[model samples]
Target chain A: MERKNLVEMVNIHKWFSGVCALRGVDFSVGYGEVVGLVGDNGAGKSTLIKILSGVYPPDEGKIYFEGKECHFSSPREARMLGIETIYQEAAMVPKMSVMRNIFMGRELARFRVGPLAYLDIPRMEEESMKALERVDLRLRSPHAPVDELSGGQRQGVAIARAMYFKSKLVILDEPTNNLSVKESERVLEFIRELKKQGISSIFISHNLYHVYPVADRIVVLSHGEKIGDFRKEETSVEEITKLMVLP
Target chain B: MRHTLLFTLRRALLLREISSLIMLLVVILVFFALSPLFLSRENVGVVLEIIPELGIVALGVTMLMIAGEFDLSVGSLFAFCPIMISLFVSEGIHPILSIVLALLLSLLLGGLNGFVTLYFGIPSFITTLGTMLIWRGAVLLISGGWPPPFSSALPTAFLVGRMGIFRASILWFAGITVLLWFVLERTDFGNWMFATGGNQVAARAMGIDTGKVKLANFMLCSLLAGFAGVIQSFRLETTLPSMGGGLEMEAIAATVIGGTALSGGVGTVIGTVIGSFLIRIIDNGLVMARAPSYWFRVFIGIATILAVILNTFVRERARKMRC
Candidate 1:
């Protein structure tokens, strides 16, 4: 059967200094599919995401987005292509306001297209509000500093920013690690909501309970190799957990 | 929380600066009261001459502190720049060309200090301190033990703030301070500088090239120091190799005393001006009152510590409230 790839990483080999990290690995994610990527500890999950987000470069491999070969030198390049990644550590300025944080790195400029033109604060606020509206939280003020928000609210804001970029692909890495039960459910709900919008997602989590329900298909990796890919309805959690832990 | 806030505000308000300003006032009054000679036009004229040149250097240092960096060599540059100007002017070179040369050299030296610190990952204080000694030594090696004398040309002499209600040095200082005020309060670069100092990683992630901003700040600071040096040399009509000695401390003290937070990201040029004037008055008064000059420095050191403690209390409280 021929596979229609949305994002294809072909023979991706990665190394840090002299230590081998990921060796000749191939993976792909299709559009409008909620894919769960599961692996044991030190299974190079972060390394894979880092390479995808342009934090690290693959020593060997070509990443083809929509079948177009691309090389990213920096995180900014990845962001421009709407390939948004929210790491376990939220990449945001803690002191800046919600509006500024939402528009950080990319700002709406006001005035007559001059070098001295002012920042379009109004436009930024408008967009920030719209983004927050999608989250549907009681965050009444977008001007409040990020430090003032709760952990779940902060996570919501990060997800909102990724979604607002008109992202075709969203990568959430361990989004529920520190969250409360309700908060985790909220994030899972948001993931389901994204799937309904026809936006594809790569949901990474070691929590099988959280991973199994929302995932359309679960991709399991052992050491540095792809172990199996099973449709959600076809595989049991115990079988996947066994595959995850089995040598 | 209320108690903490009240405690913070009290400390911040009753800062060493409050007493420093009062001390400046008391010193002025005492000098005037003690001898009619102190209040005379000639004596008053001498005191006024001190404000502008010192003020400009302090202003630049204030900005550097706000940006969370320091240029210790500014003091050496201050003396060396004037000496260079004198060296050229006394040798029959046009005064304007010599002035330009002195400032250009100052800018170049400052840029070197800034670029080396930012690009090479060396701390600014270390880099500028090294530059400071080298520049001062160069001035000494060239001028022998003494300074060269400039021509008794009226224009060159007056350029140091020898004419008008104030010295040209004071006017230049005021102008620069105002310009810096406009830039800091009005420009995107100003906001970026604060963000840079507050958290460099976030600033870079936000696409602001924080390294370049800091590098430019260092150059700007050193240029001002050099400007002050040129003023001192030309105004005095003489070049002493040791002229810039201990000036860095005074500039730093003035900045801290004026309300510029040494911890960075919060300071004002206006406060620096107030601080510089306050510092100059203390020195002048100490001299006039026949007190030991050592007392001035000792008080400034104490004031420095006091100001920092107060600023810390205020910031901690603000952080708690905001966060």
Candidate 2:
């Protein structure tokens, strides 16, 4: 069986001021594929994903989503096309309730009269709980602020939100960082669940152990360039780690 | 069992205005004990009448603060709008047209503030401070240090008419409060404001137009300040270049005392309403008790700090509670 690519970035290049961040890096993810993107700090993993997520534009390159070339001017534009990116330390609003954070930009309105509509609070609360349950995250109330939740729980909420929104490509940047052992296990499980549901995910992390079990393929970057791309069956953890640290 | 009680207490405090409400009651009682005239009809009327002038401005400031921005120029806009309205009317413009023109000017000034701040990435505190001085100087330049006489052709009954121990401005104040409260609590824009203020990076990642949200709030804050000034001018029948001079600080104080977070992303309109009343009552109560007028500022400073400490204490305890 042949799987079609859900996302394709050809020769993407990015620059900040006078410094080069990414130099002609090519990346792609197939439908229902979980790709582990690992790199050192400033390996341009965050920068690459930021460009794909429409946080900014690539200096040179073309992006094709579902076989169609697309340009996104803002994160909102990419979101409308079903690309949900959860950034490292940029997932949930700390002071907002779990339910509110889940429905932050795309709120459920009971009745909208030209941007003057009341929130469907009951529906949102119920839907958020169901979404959290899907990620196996249980809380006493959805109204509790995200600040009180553990790092793992916060990631759970972010994952639950992506699941609820029915995103085609969910990009998670270091979703397991600062998490306890149990919490990180839960997050890896979430990636497995996302694949089970036929959703493509790009999991960016620094830890190969965390990404190995869940990713179907591994892509390695070092100093703003791709050095290795291999199937999980062909590549061992040590091989990828060596490539990541290579001068 | 003890946990449930603590949970309930936390929920009650999460409402965010309870402490301010309690302070308001305490202040009322203290003044009532200190002076026989504390609750006199005239003194109560005076307090109620003036509260809306500042209350309306505070409402807008609360929304702006919740969106993680500031508008120190609101005080200047408060004076500038009315002065503009009076100038237009004297120039033979219809009274209604004059009011509309003044509000439009407010939005323009607000938009400029928002544009400069967001585009240049300057902190709103500095952007609005610069605009504050500019607008204040513009007002003085336009008015030439004298009050402008306002004789609107429109009926005074429509605006500040006496409504039996309350001026119509109180109704406007109440109406604006309800409108803004609904906008903040029940609407998508309100949620956006909270998310924007709560965490800009997170909000942006979630696909929110945080810049647009903050910009709208900046304009709204100025519009309300202008409208409140118009209301005041109608009551006074003149526009003072020095009107709303120190009002910006008072409005910010009201928001802080009402439990709105100084850092943004946490606030409530109802809390601000209570906060506005608390500030006005304290001012009126002291005067009725024959205390020095300077005591108002001293007392407000203390109350602001106490309210913040109380709110912080309650919030920290709530956060530590096990779910």
Residue by residue across B20-84, what tens digits does model 1's lDDT show? Answer: 45545765787678665776777677777878777878887878888779878988888888888
Question: Native contacts recovered by candidate 1, as a share?
Answer: 0.11
Query: Model 2 over residues A1-247: C-alpha lDDT tens digits?
Result: 1237999998999999988999999999999999999998989999999889888999999999998898889888898899999876788889899999999988999898785668999999999999999888899899988988888888888888999999999999998888888989988988888898899999999988899999999999888888889999998998888888788
Q: How well does chain A score by TM in each candidate?
A: 0.92, 0.95
Each prediction's Cα RMSD? 5.1, 2.2
lDDT of 2 by residue, B162-183 (tens): 9889999999999999999889
Q: Interface root-mean-square deviation for each candidate?
A: 3.2, 1.1
Question: For each candidate, what TM-score against the reference?
Answer: 0.79, 0.95
Docking class of 1: acceptable
lDDT of 1 by residue, A98-187 (tens): 877776656666553333335677777788989977866557678777877776677788778877877888888888888888888888
Clashes of each: 5, 0
Model 1 segments more than 4 A misplaced: A1-6, A30-41, A85-90, A95-104, A107-150, A156-222, A228-240, B1-49, B65-68, B90-93, B152-165, B254-278, B281-291, B318-323
Instruction: Find the candidate with the highest TM-score and give its number.
Output: 2
TM-score of 2: 0.95
